[model samples]
Target: MLIGCSPSYDTSQAQQVEASNKQTLAQAESSLPHKAVVYQVFTRLYGNTNTTNKPWGTIDENGVGKFSDFTDIALKDIKSLGVTHVWYTGVPHHAVINDYTQIGISNDDPDVVKGRAGSPYAVKDYYNVNPDLADNPANRLAEFESLIARTHQNGMKVLIDIVPNHVARNYQSLSAPEGVEDFGFSDDNTVEYAKNNDFYYVIGQDFSVPDAINGYQALGGEAHPLSDGQFKESPAKWTGNGSRLAKPDANDWYETVKINYGVKPDGSYDFPRLPAGFEHKSAAEHYQFWQQQDAKDIPNSWRKFEHIAQYWLAKGVDGFRYDMAEMVPVEFWSYLNSHIKHAKTDAFLLAEVYNPNLYRAYIQQGKMDYLYDKVDLYDTLKAIIHDKKSTAQIAVDQAKVADIEAHMLHFLENHDEQRINSPDFAGTPEAALPAMVVSTLISRSPTLVYFGQDVGEPARENGGFGQATRTSIFDYVGVPAHQRWMNNGKFDGGQSTEQEKALRDYYQRLLNLSHSAPALKGEYQELDTYQRKQNVVGYDNKVFAFSRFSEQQKMLVISNFDQHNGKQFSLTLPQSLLKAWQFNHTETQYMHDVLSQIQVVYPIETQADGTAKLEITLAPLQSMVMVL
Candidate 1:
């Protein structure tokens, strides 16, 4: 007589076991903190409610978002979306077209500024906040300090940008502390290179602005006293991108000047080298190691940035987002970040290092808390979303950085990247559902969400100096969709469309669940290979599957990237996973998707050789986290 096998465990006792395990897992996760979620908002763009998106518009024509715009209501709304940190980009004083001459700030020559709003990376001053961002120009510092206190009161940390590799072409700090001098102030300008000199000079050539190109002229060819193609510099310094020309090409970083960090023209270091084996040590240890070295060994530029970071920290700013971090020497980061850690042990230090090869070096030796996971994970996911590649590559990319996954930060949208809903990208926000799920849940890395990403901002406005498909960081423009969520300063979704509201709700649910889930902090294993080996019908490159589990919880996450079709298949669990979970092939499991709250029951059938199989179904652009 033939007999069917029952489940190894009884369903009646499942709830008790799950409850006990979850308690244990929660306790463990408490010791190993959950991954952070960072919300990066361009300080100038986030609160701009003006709908008049005039091209190359002056600040009067197109309004600017002020520090007062981020009211308590706005901050609390942001905190409710499961954000732990708010990176206020463009806070530092940069060159601008507006006449701040009355406030002791000189008007930037229109020839040198990128747009009427100017580029935030070309910081004009380090000791002051952007005048454009304040409600009152003379009281700008107090206004910024109040904003900092408000952010802390709302229970989220604040982050500002620090561009150490370059400064505005006319960098002048008006509010420096007593006895402190501006960059290039104490340098001997006649030399090409020196250890203590702040800049590299060309000795005899005067600075020249680039000729107009692509039917574009400075300030739209409008006449201004300073726009006569003349800027006063006795000897030219190297351009921010290392162009030695007196007149840099329009494509070069022409608006800013490079800072010298003890590297000579021959590409040799004048600063002391970090010893081998230092990359694996803690930041405190790195600080101690540097403390024993002679202060004279450090470069002058490094000390200047150190003072700047300390100044911001003293104002209650929690951390920094280092711009073009790779452009500066890695050793400088080791020195700067270690010293910052010495002052505040829990300070968050994130960098934009694009080279995957240098990821480990920057994180370990440079003492950075996180580096952008762009070239590998983000690019692969993008290709898969457009069907240019397969889902299989995600596993390979994950394996490549398995050891340093925690130090890698993941995001689908940021200021520098095209919006997911833009015509040049996915063309529809719905198409990014699967990619967003994987980017937020597949690893222990922190997650980043740009301000307007959740509301499906297409970046359709052709703001001058920055084209369509990406929000303009260089011009005065309004973010239409984000303003809908702002609801005319109410900071509610009052004016948002139903579709936009639904998308934001999805983001809120996913982010909050990710923030609280203990199993996400545990081990991960890829399940696509096991399913493919069985040759299951409808199992294709458009679908991805993975599992995360701990002593208290286990979850199987699957996503379908195909926007036009659904997927149904028999998913097989490999022997390795069965061994890890200590579940026999005949176990009958009951689970539900924590995201959508859809309950499911699956009886895992055993093949003759003890392989387990469970059926799964996913709609177009749908992702599910089946938790047990």
Candidate 2:
């Protein structure tokens, strides 16, 4: 889940639009493809070929990628990797290092900005795409729409960031459509919270710069009109990272100011409350709930976001990845998402909500399609890869969230996480093979893979505010490995090493398998439980096993997490479990490996007590899927 640290979840395959105007969730999903593979790439860094990674480099020192970089060939290459959707991060017109004054955009005060290319979450405008990404700044919105059209032509959907919890400290909407009002444009700013106001302010306090610039300077100490150590906010609002200080702590989300969603300083709701059974209500009912209310009664902030979402939908955006979703009130989500679906049914709504206690409310009432399974699955998998967790515990963890598994999007790497080959992480890309296997095939949920993850980008550069473990989301930095695959804009791996090629090939095979395989569609049983019941000796903590079956296909997956190579073991499947699938020594069957294409005949040795023990062998940190 997108913590206040870094947040997001991802998408589903773009489905055919329903013929009928009104449809159920079941109907919308049925027409859509079965599984989703989300490819999340930071838009500004995706095509940058620069290798000069200075610590606090300006845009010139380290080049930035443009919207035009996603050529038809580049997108086709991405689609060929079995991706269903492309999440283009940092697309919105956020605070950045630029002068758009002639185009009606104002300069952002650098004292509050995080990096030269500022945080994407600190959005500066609601109705525009980033001018930094356009070849022609005046036509940026058209360029973005063209990118969306190109993505659709290549059969993939688009998802962009929508930070509802906050906006840039310098919030000014230069291009809002006619009749749309800017946030705080009509506010009664005297009080901390008003039903109609968009921001919560600390009256009588002029905003002061945080004490710790930490020797950091805007534009690397180059002077500019607005880059001086001063900003113009009187009666300061709460900082985006939840700091209430007039001069927020340097560590706070200092670049942005928090939006008020009708919640008072004393933690009381100022907006209309949902009824006790509202979460159980359908979207139509939720929409009708708003329809019944007077326009004046609906909170302005709620309506403002509704207008923002509808504007993007009109521009052909499929859905939004809401940042820091849990920070906003759940009722507002109920309000905002209901209106979003009303505009475009099957709009993919993914949120970064960390509280498991709030999961059901967020999903049921907020009408969210997916949330990040970070705190549970991703964290556990990371621990297992680092030898901090036992593979034996994988089955227990899966069983705990069996009911909500489909709604939890699975991933090992995203913007917030450490790269697999980074020194702080596992320090090797191959170490994630077993973990990736389980993450992609754990359930019927969507799976997300960060760009360059397959080829092992170590992200070793010191990119400004964030650390090296994560590819810096805050700086203008080039990813070393991905740039090799980019191969001077050919969108080919012509310059990649043999190991990098092998890793990408593995990912392609795995992702394509996840999208097509039949056994994965339904009926899961952990073989680890069977091993425990049999008191199996060779099946140790470093090894894990499971089965996925439907009427036609039955598949078994096993992984060995040991450090040393070639650890052979016997994984005993109880006679009862085998009989359930109609397997016997009487019929000799070959078990086919899905990824390797190597086949092995079943060594189904029948026990005197009427059970069968299957012989299985695996390499260190390797995973295999054998078809029955």
Candidate 3:
């Protein structure tokens, strides 16, 4: 269904739709478990205490954080904010500038690496951890396992990245299990497309690194033995971003090579297709279906990744965050993820998928637990906060994905997004408070927060690959705002400023609520539409409201996005909510704002028509969660 083309339903029509929805939602909640809160931390940057943030700096100049830095106190402090899973990004062994030749690790070609510390997505070895993150390079895998054990001991699950769609340009795995060969170990180099080939090839052409263009060169024009403007692939493979050129543009994902999952050059799938009506089937059924199929019919790359996931699961890793999931075939996910579920039924699988059209296919058919809701909810909230869109548009966006709401994960900031406090974005963390509240409590889906997001990290440093608003994932750099909270490895807020401390306190309260609130795991009903129809004097499109309720708890969440004006209005609740909560139509009800430390109560006055209204006054950019 087209999102914007759908007509807005009237109150009676909405009531009928929501009544059915509430029932379906309640049943869904009964079967599913509690909500989750994910804390995403860049492994190399989280514990780095170095103050130096020189552009394109080396590991020595800009020291890297080690696996040992996540001490018990640090894990406990992270758990204090109610995080259920910690995503240690860039944990896998990837291409980098450092030479570990003596330790049996070959030097990576600089022409194919993004920075001194390389792109984590360009994974080199799936069986090992990054050498840069370990105190003893030889003991990196053991150290990472210790970190995993530490995370699990703290009552949190461990999540690591799995870049399934691609690998480093010079992919090599030295730590594969006995008799398990590396990717592309025995492929026919002459053919462009083969059923078992691991990578797509440009036959007869040699791989050439794009020359320096627009004043940009490998390693920022620095000299290195591997930066000789050439790479050694005789039969060039396709670039990670699907660029077919032997010498892809510098702006393309030139550092990585695309993995083939039986997708031919003609865009036809070489593997078996999902039978009709399989999207409605459960993961276990999918697993059973695949188990019945001939093992030789499945693609070789799919089986390789399935073994890789099982290998990590055997080592106690809890879940995976799939990068660029849409680039690969959904059929492969159905095959591999079904195998993962067969091994660990409750394994957490999150995918980075942006296309709205493919949301349901990836979730239901691909067996993904969650997908990033970036194009719809996150974009709408950002526009509303910036005063370029109306809060009412949120209702339209939500309606588009109503059936799959619980599977659409919500987040305000991640490594790919600009910081909330960055000048290019909201310019102040406080300005985004309203949006953050709505993103977290608006659905039953999981909520993710970046490591430095709680303390208002602006990401203002111009480290390496051109000065952009986002934190540099490609370079070795210190995150100053996050370092302040690190307090030189103390894991205490000893050096945080007043504003930063207050912001983190608010995050702690909000995230803890998200983790513990039963109503958040229950059904949702929009209060924005009913309130808009009432046309209260001070209420405008800038203020949005919603209600979430279960048998145990009920809450009304409201937020004011207007940055220049305070709002005074009579917020209304429709009869649907009244029936859901079984509230008396003639008597008044009281609710206290549970979001703030200071106590404040509001009275909901019920009328003869079973509708209720509450007089509320909110400061600019303020939000509230009132509980009954």
lDDT of prediction 2: 0.82
In the range 1-628, model 1's lDDT, one tens digit per residue, is 0011123456656556555644653453347667788999999988888999999888888899999888999999898889999999999999988888989998899888888899999999999989999889989999999999999999899999999989999999999999788999999988888898998888889988887789877766767778877787768989998998988888888899999999898888888777755554568788988788899999889999999999999999999999988888888898999999999988899999898878877876788888999999999999997778999888899999986787789999999999999977899888998999998999877899999999999999987888899999989999999999999989779999998999999999998878878878878899988777778799899999998877778888899999999999988878787677667444566667898865656566666766677678889999988776
Comparison by TM-score, 2 against 3, better one = 3
lDDT of 3 at 313: 97
In candidate 2, which residue pairs get closer than 3 Å at backbone N, Cα or C atoms, i.e. clash?
2-7
True-structure RMSD for candidate 3: 4.3
lDDT of 2 at 355: 80
Question: Ten residues in a row with the worst lDDT in model 3?
Answer: 1-10
RMSD of each: 9.2, 5.8, 4.3
- Report how far off residue 518 is in candidate 2 (Å): 1.9
List where candidate 2 sits over 4 angstroms from the true fold: 1-32, 213-222, 575-586, 601-611
lDDT string for model 3 (526-579, tens) is 988877787778879899999999888989999999888999988878888989
Worst 10 residues of 1 by lDDT: 1-10
Candidate structures ordered by lDDT, highest first: 3, 1, 2
lDDT of 2 by residue, 166-193 (tens): 9998888878988888888898878767
- lDDT for residue 139 in candidate 1, whole number 0-100: 92
